[model samples]
Target: MATEFEMKEIKSGDPEAARHSSMAAPQKSVTVKFENLNYSVSIKAKKTVTEKVILNNVSGMFKPGKFTAIMGNSGSGKTSLLNAGAVKGGKISGDLIINGEKMDTKFMKKMSAFVMQDDVILGTMTVREAITMSALLRLPPEIPKSEKLDRVDEIISMLRLDKAQNTVIGSTRVKGVSGGERKRTGNLIIFKIPAMAMEMVTNPSIILLDEPTSGLDSFTAYSVCTTLSDLAEQGRTVVATIHQPSSDIFLIFDDLLLLSEGRVAYYGPSSAVIDYFTKIDYPFPDYVNPADFIFMHILNNSEEAKQADKKKDALNKVLLEWDNSENKKVMLNTPATQKGLPADVMKVNASFYEQFRFLLTRAGKNVWRNALMVRARLGQAVFLGILLGLVYRDVSSRPLKSQTQALGIFLASVFEDVQVALFLAPMLIMPMMVFSGFLINNNNIPVYFNWIKYLSPIKYGFTAAAKNEFQGLVMTDQFGSLTGEKVLDDLAFTDELPVDQNLYVLLSMFIILIGMAYMALWRATKKVV
Candidate 1:
């Protein structure tokens, strides 16, 4: 029987063997090297500008088939160094070499994926739904739907989320899946790749993570790291910015990159770290967690370190000690570069129409599953319609005819939250009712300030409804004949819009409002950073 790594080698060399292996296994790998990488931002204070350095001259290498951990004390520029790979509105100068050849930002972006610390999955979706939606959007177009689904199933099984596949990842309002399952469900792949379960991850050749285990518990943290290690073992280079790890979790890491005050304190194998530090007079004692031991010494110089400067500037001495160490001589020797990457890497598999259909299907599913919200909305419509008829048993007696209900839909798109629309809807609609020919006759308004009614959607909707109900009717009861035309004249509506014109105006308002909303959201997404 061959080991897993050996089996991966076999699959890569032989097409026949590849067909039988797990599809989630990495198909390619690349070395990620950055030399003298620096990231800074300009801070203006009191008529003077100063450059605040986040990462200062940091250099390191993460090789293929290695689970490298980038750990440091809080505010030590761990996230800054990791994010330097994908510079977003920041002043960054660095040499990023992939497989020993310097690559541009465009090429670097296509080759790697960054997984943030947050697990942001829709609480309404099931585990399978979340993963399948990603798979449908990404994964190569050549692969059949049936095969893509099969790969999704394999990923579900690998993460041991088979039982929770159909469970809803619930929010704080409602109880649903377990915390661990919720975390795992959120780990779906983000970029264009096979929907491999990343759990706050994306499928890219070089995976850089910023604190994958931040909010997780001891056992869950270990489990998350184990999955990362599995990905590394499958030949992909994995880099993660991790915090205080348990001894067991630390042991899972192949290489360790330690930093202090924006400088590389040590960069080498995890096992050799003890010897590396011991040679510099910082000896590690037995029967203590290696992570805790390291943090105790290094974090002593950090800003928040309790009683900092117990000794004279421990940070500078430790950093200087590393500058003269033999480990500093180690350099990134990237493997031979590939002529080209896989065609399906980060490539969209479906056409626009197909993607739209899938998105529509998902929208339908979300609406169906949110039964409470749907039922509440339906109940409101039925209850309100009946109440309106009761209050105004006769149509002519009704006081309100609001057409701005569609404004809620418009507002929802603009605010990007339904609750905001719901809260602000009544406040806006009440003014339209009072000012739009409902409270007093239009002709009785002040001459200088009488133009507000034209802004009211209620003005047109009410006129249209009244014309539709009593346009040709004539009523007489021991009084002069009251024709519908006479009623309109008395209400100062004879010069108002005709029924057909009012109907058209309302329709046009709805369309224009909705179109503006769509444009607002589309523009918001155009921002790259």
Candidate 2:
């Protein structure tokens, strides 16, 4: 039951070409295929909350290389469907297939690239760096660095991002690229944007993009459509949930799979959508786009648009019949037979590195590129050391010096506090670094107080200062003699020992503080992601 567009586009110009395309289809297939795939998410009811049914037994074949749009009103299961297909922990019951092989729920994550509605780009990377880092992490090792750069270059070229190629991607406050540019970069890193497609090896055969043009202008949205259409032409399955696209973008779709209250109301060629509605007596208005018309119709119906209701019975019956009919199953299966494979089918060894050189190169590149950042940070450490050393320069064998040095050592311990804070900086500032060193990852900030977190840098820079300030000091006071505890009670304890025991202890504290901070950072990012 592949839609006509999917079938026609693949079978269009040359039969031999179509055959080759089919051979390239992803291996594996899905079962009972979303048979009764329904879901609901609970929300707290007291805080102006709304209850929603995200999806309802909506099923369809996701053929390789076919561009499909999952059309629906806001809160419909479009995003839910994509999430279910990609991420897990949903209330799922249907089977997803690939080449007749049942898609193991546990393995679905490895098989899909899900670009969420909100752009998930880290704010500090340049376009090429983001894409390159992603390539290093995910691309098959068969693609070399030279080829990877070429691939990045091609994607940058394809996106018409030549002007902003070297621009940093971040918010306006941080000063860098524009929103569209950053969105594209984020997508590129995750393989939703065109720039990363050329060298993508670990990319899922089926791409699920949620609102690929959610925040763009008409022209930009159109550009996104064109890019996706080009991907489809190249024989990759593209599924996107979009809203309010202009007519120009509407036409680029091969199929429009419309949803209403979690049900498939229309799943066919974009050209035939209006006719399908007209045939069902819910004709589109004279000037209304069919996409808009359908959304209006569903919205007017509300949550009460039950299949068995009689007032709007004609529309509901027709759509429901279509869903239950054997023809729909045929539509679901057509892609398989056309490609000579089943759904949920997987092929192509996603394992990119089976060799040592490949892994070492990735590791080496990571270390090399980070060399400057690391050194600059370490230089800050040395500067802190000078400052602290100067601050505690007067520690001596006298009682006054012992008291002063003891206080200095305590202030130096603040460096340990600062070191702890510095390591935590990466946890908050670059969590994804723990993953692939690609971009800085910031967790969600509360709407009211996020600004405070944005300006704080005390955690990262203070520790280095403390460690450099307090090592190798002999401060003696009469209090040590008076107390008989040698705790700086008297100035009696002068030391040749400052360079040995005291220095070693101070150095140990420095190393210990740094080690603790680094370990904390590693664990935080690992756990957070």
Candidate 3:
């Protein structure tokens, strides 16, 4: 019952394919086996909190040269199970082994390429640029640039993306590559069988995908599955959580692991699924797709009180049957081996300097391409500078009238700029500006409110600006004339912080604030689970 798309030429013997082919020699294989895996999270409601189990004692095996599909109804722990196996977060209790060796999540993350359901692609870059950048950053630094470029070209050809290789991987704001093409641009770490073929550079032994065909047409989904099949054929152990797939799509999978209520309903070869279910008295109807038939029986769709009970009973029965099956014993009893695969080999090959250079170049390109945003920021800076200058004008000529005004302008400018750059609200920034000792003299201000001035960067800038303008000038009121020293005493500027001291404090504040801002930006950009 294979469709035309399913039977289309697989390009298995192409030069690009041959380069990745495992048939030439028996490539190193990875076998992932999990036993008694349980995942849970604490949930709070009103005044009470409880633990919700996501995966309950789930056990299975994923072997190289096979495509294993994990499928379930909504809220059936499909994503949680995938995350438990591939990601290191949440509370998980399990025995996860790779190649008969107990492997930690960190080690697994390096050895496996996890293609998330969502496309994590740089929208600005063309298809070729995105893939090439990933290759440069990920492929061993020891490899020559030419060889890397050749690898990228080979991947581009292998994935059949030559037609749109130069097209931008656009965002919602901009039109770029087609949806199918975007789906191919997956995460860099793990082997994702997307159109970009980014993981081929690493030749990872294990590839894990979450809903690889969730947002594609039947034909595109079939093509994606075919690509995964080809990768599996080359000795990669491919595991993906698939949604309701078409009959042709189902045929592509070598093994199936179906879940119900966080418990395994079935796990076996795709070909034996119909027969297995029939033996359990859940016979398939005539001319119905096996995937659809299985979903209809396992998933709870009934709203009727009586039918709901029947569905629950049927699901429980299936779970109990799986618990008693011989397959469960075989999967849980797999022995651990002494394979020594160093976790460092899976670590990013580029040195820290190389990584920094690559990131800096990419960031520069992104900023340069967004010309409108850069120009707008520059315009704002110029306007603010001009405004500050105008407000602080004539400080020397009219020292008495403009000295305090200049101090206020400098303080406000420095404080406001820092606040805006840090994304602080005006409501929060206004209080700091008011307490900076510009409008209210620090000595005259109440004792309790005076401490706010100590924390203000504006205080340093104001003192520095006032001393620079009025240090040696003469100040006069209508009644009398006063020396700059007298004026400094009147404003409490002659006490502890001199002009040089104020300037140094302001410089320190600037450096500290800028460093904090950079750290915030770095954390924001870093990937967190």
- List the global CA lDDT of all models: 0.67, 0.55, 0.73
Q: For candidate 2, what is the TM-score?
A: 0.64
Q: List the residue pairs that clash in candidate 1.
A: 187-199, 187-200
Residue 202, candidate 2: Cα error in Å is 4.7
Q: Cα lDDT for residue 165, model 2?
A: 78
lDDT at position 48, candidate 1: 98
Model 3, span 476-500: residue lDDT tens: 6676676767666777888748878
In candidate 2, stretches whose alpha carbon ends up further than 4 angstroms from where it belongs are 1-33, 39-53, 105-111, 122-124, 188-204, 301-329, 332-335, 338-393, 419-485, 488-529
lDDT of 2 by residue, 317-404 (tens): 7667677666577667554533223343243332545434445665565444454556887998899889878866755456455446
Q: Given candidate 1, what's the lDDT at residue 112?
A: 70
Q: TM-scores, in order shown?
A: 0.76, 0.64, 0.84
In TM-score terms, candidate 3 sits at 0.84
Candidate 1 residue lDDT tens string, 217-311: 88777776777777777778889888898877787788899887788888888877777777666777765667888898755565564656653
